[model samples]
Target: MLEKRFKLSANNTTVKTEILAGLTTFMTMAYIIALNPNILTNYGAGGAELWNGVFLATCLSSAVAMFVMAFLANKPFCLAPGMGLNSFMAIVIGQLVATTGMGYVQSFQSMLCIILIEGVVFLILSLLNVREKIVDAIPLGIRLGISPAIGLMLLNIGFGSNVYIADSNFNQFFVMKDFFGALTASHARDVMTDAYPVMVLSAITMFVGLFVIVVLASKGVKGAVIIGMLAASVLYWVCDAVFLGSNPFASLATASFVPAFGDMASTTLFKFNFAGLAQMGWFTAVTLVITFCIIDMFDTIGTLVGTASRAGMVDREGNMPNMKEALLSDSVGTIVGSCTGTSTVTTFIESASGVEAGGRTGLTALTCGIAFLLCIFLAPIAAIIPAAATSAALIYVGVLMMTGLKKVNFDDLSVCVPVTIMLIGMPISGSIGHGIGLAMISYTIIKVFTGKAKEVSGLTYVISVLFLIKFFLAV
Candidate 1:
């Protein structure tokens, strides 16, 4: 039944392979389950009930989107309340509170209304094939650059932001950018205090896990990512127990296994405050909605194109099959997220981990969706996997994706400059959409001034102008 549904043989994959790939993808991106609620609830200022609500919403909405991607689009990508979008949603909530004199909970519900409108806009665009046209509008040069750009972004996450050590005051120290980049070990020690040694352990664990996966992959081993992650997780556990004098599984003793369905039901489920939304004024609401739409549309498009390219799912012209279905699934995710209470749900770049693990069909997505549903009851178990372990998978996947740069035509200044900008922009800006936006603007400017204005497509021109306005002119 599974094979017939997912066409496993047609995609040259087995049930085992797809399932393992799905697990790999889940392990890599599961941070969202805990982090989304924390960010959206403003570190509990919105109350514990709100936190629990967003937590279930994150799990439920992500599962819904992944299921849609599986059955409707047959894509391996997973969806979640996106990291950046959630942060922006939090900001918008804060602003709405300040400007409209609404309470935080009221403002949050109003923002959900905004998210619902944004999702409806995306659904309309996707069903009308406008989203597919936007994808098609990206130049071949810029399209080919997406994978390598996303690779750099992964490296940024893996090494720069993946693992952090907290001080006594709860200040974060990034292992790579803070510890190793410190003037000296003593300087790092002074800043991180008792947390410095944990940073060292993370560095060692990350490299060990990365090397393990690399060696296994070199030997053509299947499930190398999961194996490496398991090995690294065990190592982290031992180190924490023996050296840090802490029990890694101690949290499992007191962690709640309940789904918090009641919190979601009362706090966030179908809680759209249209009165508060109207109080925010139409201009503020419209501007925020447009911003959300532009950022989310391109972010999803970039992740799909980039990861699909890395997985060899794109054709010669850099277009993926089932593009419309995929975009529509993303819209569905956001709509469901608003109703359930979370940020915009979009495709995650971490899906590349699964693709690299040999996932080739909807079975992989189905498996991931099931895991997300399971997380509602087993969040604690997933949380103990150790951030260092997933860092290894991301770094390894990034290294592999960087190989796509060989296909770029560096001799062409137009392609080289835009691709180069995008490659750097993704990591620095921490936004796939912003990176692609810069690439488009650069590509369009180069072509227009070089007597090649006629070569640029009409939609590309319009998108370039839109991004330009988004970057500098939008209120």
Candidate 2:
């Protein structure tokens, strides 16, 4: 039955391979199960009940979305509440709370309404094939640049550090003058010596794990990254036990493996408040919706194209098979996620892990969906996997994604210039949309000024103008 449904054999993959690949993918991205709830809790302002609600919502929504992807798209992609989008939601919620003097629950309810509206908008776009048209309208140069740009962005995130000063409430990042000043500061040695050893150890562990994954991958080992992450996690556990004298499993003792049904029912399940939409004003609501739609659209597009390219799913023209179905799956995931009280659930680039692990059909996604369901009972175990371990997987995946850069045509200035800007802008701007927007605007300008405007499609021109407006309004 599985064979006929997923065409596993036709895809040159077996049930075993698909299951292993799914497990590998789940291990790589499972940190989100805990991390999402941690972020949404907002330093306990939401209270334990809300925290538990978001946690349950995260798991259920992710599982449902992954299952939808499996059956509807027959693709090996897993959907989850996205990292950047979640962070953006937190910030927006905070702003709303501060500006409107509303309680956390009300602010959260309002944000859910916004996400619900955004999901509906996306569903309409997907149904009308507008989303697919936008994808097709993107120039080949910009499309090729998206993967490498995201690669650099991931690399930047993996290596960046922040220092917390005693008096300051916020973390002080080492950027601009602070980064260069560290080179000659008289307090540099003191700062290094006084720095927490755990931070240093974490960084070292991440690099070592990343190195191990790279070596194993080079040797053609299946699930090499997952193995490396597990090994690195063991090392971290040992270090914590020896140096901190802490019981590594102490958290498990306090964690509730059983679902908190009362908490989930009380807080956020179908508790969305559309009344908050009127409070946000028409302009704010519209801008927020547009922002979410644009960001989520491109993020999904980039992940689908980048991972599909690596999986050999993209054709000579850079189009993936069943893209509309894949996109529909994404939109449906977002809608379900919002209704369940989480952020936008979209296709994860970490799906590339399963692709690299040899997943080729919907079976891999089904496996992942089942794994997510199991995780509802294993939250404690999932929580124990340190960020340092998953950082290694991200770094390794970023390295693999950089291979897309070689496909860009650098000989032509018009193509090269926009692509170069996108490649550099993504990491620096910390936004895929920003990178693609800059590239499109530049590409249109260069083509027009160089008397090659006819080469640019009408859709490209329309998109370029929209991007220009987005940037202008952003400023």
Candidates in order have lDDT scores of 0.93, 0.80
Lowest-sum lDDT 10-residue window in model 1: 179-188
Judging by lDDT against the true structure, name the best candidate: 1
Q: After superposing candidate 2, which stretches have Cα over 4 Å from the reference?
A: 161-189, 192-195
User: Per-prediction count of colliding residue pairs?
Assistant: 0, 0
TM-score of predicted model 2? 0.91
- Per-residue CA lDDT of model 2 for 221-301, tens digit only, reads 877877888888898899878986768789988888898868878878888877776788888988888888878888898
TM-score of each: 0.99, 0.91
Per-model RMSD to reference: 0.9, 3.1
Clashing pairs in 1: none
